[model samples]
Target: MPLHRIPVTADLIRGALDLETTPDGGLVPHRLPPRARARNTDPQLAAVEVQPSGVRLAFRTRATEVELEVRPTTRVYAAAPPRPPALYDLLVDGTLTAQSAATGGDTLTVDMTTGATELTPGPPGTVRFTGLPARLKDVEIWLPYAQKTELRALRTDAPVEPAAASGRKRWLHHGSSISHGTDAASPTAVWPAVAASLGGVDLLNLGFGGSAMLDPFTARAIRDTPADLITLKVGINIVNADAMRMRAFGPAVHGFLDTIRDGHPDTPILLISPIHCPIHETTPGPGALDLPAFAAGTLRFLATGDPGEAAKGRLTLVTIREALERIVTQRAAEGDKLAYLNGLDLYGPDDKDLPLPDDLHPDTATHRRMGERFAERVWGRDGSLEGF
Candidate 1:
């Protein structure tokens, strides 16, 4: 069969927070918009935003085979174990049909001890899928949210056209690595995607790994975006980074909300506190990787700050929950379409045994549970997100 090359452009992509154009006529999906990204200097933020967790290329085709040429930047840590290769999910008419991965992409090596990083560029990799349904249907190619992918070209046995926009509400969600799909089985299996699917909404995930701190630029991005629904899964990144004190946190939350409200005056906004992270639940953070666990072939995190720091106004998950509840209550009283959902309700004491394997981000199963719960509580009949 003759291959038909389709230009890979933003018009064919969805769920990207932003798209960065490349010099080679390619496009890199970014989870953070450029205006919002220019203000942050953190390399971690820069890297993760470009991972494209919930982004996908959608088109209509009748091809039995599809192929995408991608240039991925695989992250590597000098002392850490080798990271897994990124996966691409192929969906036909909204159902997962196949999955594939590419090889021979760029490698970004980070030296933890010296805090230096280097990038060794490599050749583009091709992700191909065969045996797909040979009838005209909507096809979606979901990029890895955990890897940086630059789209070089797309080809199919049949010609393709962009999928029409759906009528579902646009859900703009901001959170940390878990929402960025750090350990999700695939881009679509991420909690936010699952929840969006169950909730009947279109997803625009802004879950920047390690960078969900209440930055003004992020708020501005949220404010400027056109979203019918918005959710801020706050606290974990702030507490883990030890980025703010309690006294500063409340005001920061208010400022973030105020900025978002500037553009979305009455959008249904949900504030979600951190989920059940035992290490940071009561103990204040600065969380660090458990080096011993790392050496033992398991990845784990441990709180590094003194538990007593809470007395000094240091923030913890517990404190953050309380603060978020209070803030939401006050804002709601002012007639804002705002609501609060305790993270514990999503993942609580009863879920202790579930595989949060890393002791931080939820595993695939936990993500499903969270997504289901979120759908029931926020989008179900008579749920908090019922109207608007």
Candidate 2:
């Protein structure tokens, strides 16, 4: 049977706030809005913002075989360990059915010591998924989390149309690399995506890697997006960057939440503190890549700031957790529909079997574990999000 090409339009896209038209007329999904992108100056944040953490192509089709032509640009550090290619996940009727990857496209090489970047242009490749069920069903092709992808074309054996909305509550989430899917197994394996699936909710993930720094623009973007539920995972990134001291941290958190509340005054907001990170539990950050480990083709992290800095108002995971609890408590008194969750409940100290390989980010298995725990706690019966 001859395959018919379908124009990948905005109606078939989900979870992206903006769709940037590529030079080739392809579409690049952006988790951030145009105004938010315009406001950002940090290159790190800019790169991660277009990573398409929870972005996917959604439609209804009876196709048994489908092909998606995408220009996937994967980044690699010169003189560092070679990274594996990110995966594309296909879901039929809300269940994961197949996983594959586009082998070659563009390669972005970064000079680690110097902040230099080189993009070696390459051809766009197609990711093909076959053996899908014959009956008409909802189909979703989840783009890789960290890889920058520009979708060019979609081809299928059978015709496709806009998928019916699930009528589920939209869960808007913002967090650090863990939620951005630093080392997740696949796109759908990202903790936020996983939890969204289990909870039967739509996800709008603004989990930028090393970029969830409590910026005003991020808060404004969240405030502007319509969502039935919201979650803010704070602390780890602040500790990682050693971005602020106690004097600024408190006000910053308040300001971030305040902006989100401006648009969603009564939306149930869950503020989650940092999970178990031994390096930053009591120590201040300015964390550095473990050079020796990196040289040996292994990635690890080490905190450089002094533990005593906490006395001088330097924030740590320990201190941040206490502050978050207090903030939620104070807000609740004012009749804010707010709740607090110690992120440790999602991935705590006791889960020694599932280790965070880098001393920072969770591994793929840990990501799934965290998602399962999150679903049980926040979406289960008598849960924080259940009755609210």
Candidate 3:
């Protein structure tokens, strides 16, 4: 069959804030805009921002066979058991019709103990979807959120073009690794993706792994982006990193919301607290990975900060939740369009049946549950986000 090469362009991409040109003429999708990325210099932030968590190639095509050339860079812990290569999800007309994982690509190994890195380069590979519906329909191929994937090319037996707008509400969400879909079964299985599917909204996920620090640049990116509804999942990373004290946390939250409000004054914004994390629920943190556990081939994390530190206003999940409640209530009384959701409503002590696998991120089933609950609360009839 003859294949038509479709140029990898921004017009055909979704969930990426900017598309940077690669050295090999490919395109690298960025979650953060150019100006924002320039000011920040954290290697972790730079790494996750380019991983394409919610990014995808979206178009309308009648192609029975579709192929995407990808240079996928997979991350591995140097001394830990290898993780499965991330999967690519192909959705046809809003349903998950197919899925594929990269067959060959580069590998980036990091020493969890020392934070050193080594790269083993490998050849590029293809993710193909065959026997797609022959009739013209919407096609979305979700990128591997777990890997750094560069789009080399898109080829199909049938022609492809930018998809017509579906008129769905645009939902912008920013959170930490949990929101970034770390342990999600596949790209589209992330909670936000599932929630977007159920809510009938287009998702622009700003969920970066280990990087949602309430930074002003991130807030500005959200500020400039257009969205009908917005949600901020805070507290987990703050507590895990023990990044700040309660006094600083409140103002940081306010400033983050304030920056977004500058661009979306009337947009419905939901400020969500950290979900139930028993380790950090009462205990404060600077979460530390259990190195011995990892060396023993079992991954685990422990909160290092003392619970007694709360008396000194050191942050914890419980402390942040209370502060968020008061903050949102105060803002609402002042006529702000902000609402609050306890992340526990999405996952809590009752969810012990689906415990976070690594003691940090949610598993596939939990992601599904959270997504469903989020949709019901925000998109269901009489949903808090309904009127907006």
> What is the per-residue lDDT of model 1 for residues 1-388, given as tens digits with 9 covering 90 to 100?
8888877987899987677788988888887777877898997898888888889999998889899998998888777766666789998988888999887789888875466999999999899999998889999999988889999899889988899987878999999998888787888889999998787788999998888999999999899999988999999999999999988999999999999999999888999999999889889889888888777766678899998889899999999999999999998999999999999999997996795777898988999999999998889765447633
Candidate 2 least-lDDT 10 residues: 379-388
User: Can you tell me which runs of candidate 1 are displaced by over 4 Å?
Assistant: 112-114, 381-384
Q: Model 2 off-target regions past 4 Å?
A: 382-384
The candidate that wins on lDDT is 2
TM-score of 3: 0.97
Q: Pull out the clashing pairs in model 1.
A: 53-145
Q: Which model is ahead, 2 or 3, in terms of lDDT? A: 2
Task: Report per-prediction Cα RMSD to one decimal.
Answer: 1.6, 1.3, 1.3
lDDT of 2: 0.91
Give the C-alpha miss distance for residue 142 in model 1, angstroms: 0.7
Q: What C-alpha lDDT, on a 0 to 100 scale, does residue 88 get in candidate 3?
A: 93
Backbone clash total, candidate 1: 1
Instruction: Give per-model TM-scores.
Output: 0.96, 0.97, 0.97
Candidate order (lDDT): 2, 3, 1
Write one digit per residue (lDDT tens) for candidate 3, span 218-292.
999999999989999998988988899998999999999999999999999999999888789889989999878
Could you tell me the lDDT of residue 51 within candidate 1?
86
